[model samples]
Target: MRLKPRQLEAFRHVMLTRGVTAASEAMNIAQPAVSRLIRDLESEVGMTLFTRQGGRLLPTPEAVLLLAEVERLYIGIDQVARAADDIRQHLNVVLRMASVTSLVRPFLHRAMMEVVGPRLDLPLVLDVENSRHIWDMVEQSHYDLGLVFGPPRQGDLQTVHLHSSTAVAAMPPDHPLAEKDVITPTDLLDCRVLTAGRNSPLRRGLDRAFSQAEQAPLNTLETSMLNCCHFAAAGMGVAIVDRITMRAADVKLCAKPFLPTIDVSYYAARPAGSRQILVLDQIVERIKELLDEDTVIAS
Candidate 1:
């Protein structure tokens, strides 16, 4: 009794779609052919994998257990294929990277492209979200590496600091504060400010800075996207954002160092007991080198 690779693929697809008709359509095969494959597979294994009810395929208990094992097997197969491709092309291994939304474009994406070179045979699948979600995914081993704006304060994770940069204030070119070499919390007392949402690290830092400075808080327009804040800034609102974000915007905005500069350090992180730490370390080191190169070129 041998279950072939094609049978396994059919079973996995049926389980995923939970409908033989849809699975058959996806596989570009006739429904009867899919049904025959599943039947043959069950006969060989001596177990009923699915039960049909209300025209839907429902997995049996045995099928659920088998599905988990099958998923792992497929993942291993994928890794093998990817590894072979990398070797054939003389490329670094493919890495799955996740990062907070704000850092994805200007920081993580650029740094990786610079360090990994323009011809990337090694692919990176990037997931961008808020820091909390990124941390959650990393802890669950959903990503090979994670880039975060600040150190993890609550998670049991391993981290390597990539680099630190100062926060800056952005405003439209014609805005009053745009002419300043630098701006302080006191200077923004009555201004309308655009910022990332309250949960963001940048927002948290700005709140603390304002509290310490004892300045009245400005009216804040909160959004989760750094780009949106930049857009608002270009529309005549003052925005306090990381320098990396400000520099990437295409709007007519001026960026100035924020007084008592809010410094941010980005870190690469993975779960504490991860076996893939070596790969993540390589990525972090490469990013740091890229940042150094950028600094040298700019200077």
Candidate 2:
């Protein structure tokens, strides 16, 4: 009863694709061949992997447990293949990075340009995702690193605090609140407020602030903090956003220090035990340098 790689691969594909026909196409094997592999795997493991129902393969309880282990195994194998490709030095080593949209444009882009040399054709695979998605990708080892706001939601991740900037109130220069040195929820009582979506950390904190002031965001418009700045600049509404995102946003707006000094933190999250490569380390350092610079515009 020797377990084979091909058997596990077939089992994995079948479970993933949910049918032998699709699994065969994915693995580039005939339908019967895929079926045979599954049968062999099932016999080797002594369990019913799947129960066929209406042309779909429904995994048994045992199969579900095995699939998790198989997926983890394949992730390691994929990492090994990538390492081998790096060793071969055929093309430039691909750096897979994922970050929230807030950091993608001016911050991460600039960091990569500064870190990756001009003559060196370092390949980059970047995904602009939400913080949660970026966290999952980096934790699952799908990405080399992830840039996210606040600490990671999941546990056992190594988080490097890149920068901490106080949140600011953004508005058009012509707006009346522009005269104020500091903007508060009370100041925004008459103005349309563009803010983070409800339940988000920023939103929750803002809600608390508004509660303390005995005020609410009237004429509320929900959007990301980056978009909040851009929209506010376009005269849509005043926005409350971190100085980092405000600085990064390519817009002309007045950024007054928001009241109560709400601080936002950015972090680079990676797998807990993963080893840092030289190229990634340099990119991370460059990002740190870029963030440390003050580029926020307050008109």
Candidate 3:
């Protein structure tokens, strides 16, 4: 009835990478050894975890359920490792935060430094991920806090609004649309626009704007809001997303107002179990102050 750590590890990697050979490489073991581990795990669970289909290992229904549980188990294991790190360093608490890329540098990092400044040895793990991933990390209690796109969908997360801004039309400095003070969907009729993917909340808002103009986005590229600027700067298309992405992009891009604006907001979300309340409060306040002063957020 007991499942071994190596067995679970092999099963999880197989489910994630989708092949025994790939899983073996990831676990730094031989391919046949991976097959044997999977077989032993299947025996322990008494279920067929995978079926071969077109040279791919496809998870069965039971395997899918096991994968979810296995993932949670791994998350717990990761938390334990972090705890061990904290103890090894003889720290009372460590700050683990995840954030969207747009929220860093001139914004979140400055605020974080002001709070944790004096403690040079203080362990801080700041992970930069997409907002969707940040949301999940905070909700799962993997991180103490997360700065992400607003309107927290998870009921358990306590959040405070940090900033709000309108989406903009971003393009290369010399793009035709850059000539307009305010770019609308009609202005982009002949252009290939870049926009958030269909699954994104930003996409829904952008779709409404296009609908109001009675125009299709003409956007052939569906990407992350962050990538909109990068893709547009390459002259692939015009970007319509939060201004921060355009300003945050490594390459230069021009951001202009978008007619029929799409508003976007970011918030600080955290679970109730955080011990760094004073530091969190200070960081939140500092971010709000920076948001007010940072012209990049004034879009």
In order of listing, the candidates' clash counts read: 0, 0, 0
Once fitted onto the true fold, the runs of candidate 1 whose alpha carbons sit more than 4 angstroms away are 1-95, 110-124, 154-156, 277-280, 296-299
Off by over 4 Å in 2: 1-93, 119-121, 152-154, 295-299
Query: What RMSD does each model have against the real structure?
Result: 14.2, 15.1, 19.3
The ten-residue window of minimal lDDT in model 1 covers 274-283
Tens digit per residue, CA lDDT, model 3, 1-299: 99999999999999888889889999999999999999999999899999999988899999999989999998999999988886665366667888887788667878877877888766678899877888888878988888887656758677888878888888889997788889888888888888887756677888888877876655468877778888888998988888666555667888888878788888898876654466667888898788877755453
- Predicted candidate 1 versus true structure: per-residue lDDT over 118-184, tens digit per residue: 6545666788777777777888878778887775656678887777787778887787777888899
TM-score of each prediction: 0.60, 0.67, 0.64
Sliding window of 10 residues with minimal summed lDDT for model 2:
290-299
TM-score computed on alpha carbons, candidate 1: 0.60
Give the per-residue lDDT digits (tens) of candidate 2, residues 168-287: 888988999999999988889898999987745677778778888876666889988888988999899999887677777878888788887676888998887977677778778888
Off by over 4 Å in 3: 1-92, 273-276, 296-299
Instruction: Indicate the TM-score of model 2.
Output: 0.67
Cα lDDT, model 1, residue 35: 91
lDDT of each: 0.75, 0.82, 0.82
Residue 274, model 2, lDDT? 76
